[model samples]
Target: MELEQFEHTIRKLFNKELLEELDDDYGFTNKSRGSFKTVGYSTNLSLETIESAAENNVELMVTHHDAWDFIYGLKEECLKKLKEYNISHFWIHGPLDFVEFGTCTSLMNVIGIDRVTKYSIYDNGDVPGVGEFNEPIDFNVLVKRMRDELEEPVRMWKNNEKQVKKVGVLTGAGHSSNYIKMALEDGCDTYITGEATLYTIQYAQFAGINLLVGSHTFTEIYGVESLAKKIQELNTAIKIVKLKEDHFELNH
Candidate 1:
């Protein structure tokens, strides 16, 4: 219940060495409460999410991604509310990305896989994560599988009719041609990620790789949810609320 207690538990489960490598922080650790009864979880430390936590009376706010060291635009606004409500904010970044039930693995699990092998690398060659699928599936069927697991529609750029045997998942903003190249080299017929650029579409067609691109926010929800579930299982008394923004779709 203490700040030290919460952080200690997190560090133990997520690995202290990884946390330091990511420079993960307790965003706002000061509070008068002896113990935290509720936890608010979000992907970013944005103004809207911070306000939602305060309104819900959440004692601690946990964000899976941390932007404080890079982005400063919304920090002041978010801090005002967090300070006012005496809510503590903490970030669990790279450590949560490749855990046993991490972002990439969770996606593969939802989409269904016979076995998994880690692929993507992060933090100086450490494989943060990627899943290797054994069964070859149709491109369209793979897209449907991704959408079914995401519970949201995905925008796809289909290239050759190659049945997808090896699929690589990177979760958010992982739609670059470079990643596609990696997939191709690794013999992946399809690359599944959150968002894509116009250039990548044509590239995929030429490279003969299929892609499933969905909303960034939508693709990134699983990691935090999985973490919360584990945390709650360990500490049955804390209330964990996942605050999410509704899907915003744009069409032209």
Candidate 2:
């Protein structure tokens, strides 16, 4: 399909108004191609991901995050490679986080969040953030479920022996103390996010909340994969490939 139509469909799928509220970098980073037969989806744009797209003959790449170094204006190499391969690069960041079946919601579904109680506020709107289980679960049991479902190492701060009932979720580097505080205020006994820092752990402990953290990539990958499926449902003619970052590993 034509890249323009594909992008239009994506915008509609993710809600155009929400996308407009995000930074300019949240959409098509580079449009080197006009059309594509195959599209690749991944959690982030990296040299390795670009190479994999090239190897898979993907004419377009839809990623959850732009290359981090692009903030420093140093993604020239990646840009050159995309140009060389004639691969278009598109990013869906905050919108994906806010959309239905998005990052946080997807993670929540995976871990059995029964009902949504609160949302994380973005610039113009809010997304699912805090939820509750049908019944309280043991903290260790919840951690094991997260580890098994995410298939990634889990780093946790077990603040108490309380059973996890009300829980908050924010995927992809969403482990800020501010979010933790919000969860606590929302009456969540547990909080889950992609990654956390020392301060995040301390704050969760002080706030008396259980914290469950997964690798940044693995936690957010589900949303991208879901997007790929959605795109394929829109246009079955356009092949969708889900790319993996084999190099990313969390060693504790």
Candidate 3:
């Protein structure tokens, strides 16, 4: 299918307006945008992911994080590889996270939390910062379950807690003290997310709520994978490949 049509289809499927962020300064070349047969989806558009798509002959790579950040200009190496292979980058960022069944809720389900609800405030229709789990559980169990469920090691900042009944989740770097504060206000005993900030770590201890950080990339897999699955179901004419991340730095 034409790349434009493919993008349009995706926009409709995921509620385009929700995904308000895009690489406004960057877009694919005319030749590269003409067609897309195999679509690759990832939470991060790392060099590994781009190489996999290019090597596998994927026409486009859809990612939650920009392949090149605005601050860095672009990854010159990755750019050359994309141009060399004629693969395009597509981003589904903030809007993707803000959807009703997006990141927050997906994380809640993955961690096996019960009575998960979109209780966090949102910048759009979907909540970005919070999900509340109704049942309290042992802090240790929650850690073990999350590590097992995400298939990644989990880091934590604890407040000498024993149990976690009510919990809040803000997947990825969304694990902010701001949401943790709100979670505590809502009676959540623990706050779960990825990439806990330094200040937030201090705050979690002071606020007396258990804070859990699953590696940022792993916590985010749920939403993008779910998105990829939905995209795959829409049609077989288009091949969608999920470029799963294979490595995680344990002590980084």
Candidate 4:
């Protein structure tokens, strides 16, 4: 499928005008592709480049971030997009991380840590509710796993000296005292987020739970790719294009 065709279909379905603002708010744009190849570097006015690269027919469209920009809008956009395009759209975002076979679940599985639970407590209603692992692992062990898995050293705010057994898993900056309180309510010994803030750290310390800080992009990398890979296995004709987004740096 031509990239432009898909882009147009997606935009029309989602109402690009409304969706575009959401992307701007989150500073969403292409970040990097990590050695992945693109069809060309030239900029064309039309969707010609995307179409040429995608060829005549693209089967599936995979997005790293939520395409809707907002979940409520997402539902409406999804209904519209699905109806217009023969292409199937799959999104892997916050919920995809915590649920079984989700990103955070994948992370936990890789590390062989059990005793986890996940839920969505993001009161903002913008970010969806995600999983939280109630089981804790040694602080150092969790740290090592974060560093090794992400291929980058992580910065953390250790609110408690105790080992982390119960963990709240909210990928990205869904970090807020509200969710932290939810994790605590769920008996999570630690809270894991993509990023942290001053008040959040204080809340974690006061709540008596460990806080694990990973990059929002770094933490979310797995779920969408994993979903795409799964889609490819099911159908080879479907080309899953993982876009270069999540371009941001840790200020700390």
Which residue pairs clash in candidate 3? Answer: 18-95, 19-95, 98-126, 135-165, 136-164, 136-165, 137-164
Per-residue C-alpha lDDT of model 2 across residues 86-172, encoded as one tens digit per residue = 899998888788777788877887878788766554743333288898989889988888899877768888897789899888887
Look at candidate 2 and tell me the lDDT of residue 69: 71
- Candidate 4, position 229, lDDT: 57
Q: Report residue 227 deviation for candidate 1 (angstroms).
A: 1.2
On residues 1-252, what C-alpha lDDT tens digit does candidate 1 reach at each position?
A: 677777667866776566667664333433546579898888777777877888888888887765464575666666666788888887776676756777777777778765677634464633424455576777778788778867777888777776777777777777677777777777777778888887778778888878788777667777778887777877888889988655654452
Per-residue error (Å), model 1, residue 208: 0.7
- Model 4 shows how many backbone clashes? 20
lDDT tens per residue, model 3, 50-88: 888877778888777765456374567667777788788
TM for candidate 2 is 0.91
Model 3 RMSD vs true structure: 3.2
* Candidate 3 lDDT trough over 10 residues, lowest sum: 22-31
lDDT of 4: 0.52
Q: Specify the highest-lDDT model's number.
A: 2
Report residue 131 deviation for candidate 2 (angstroms): 1.8
Please give the lDDT score for candidate 2.
0.82
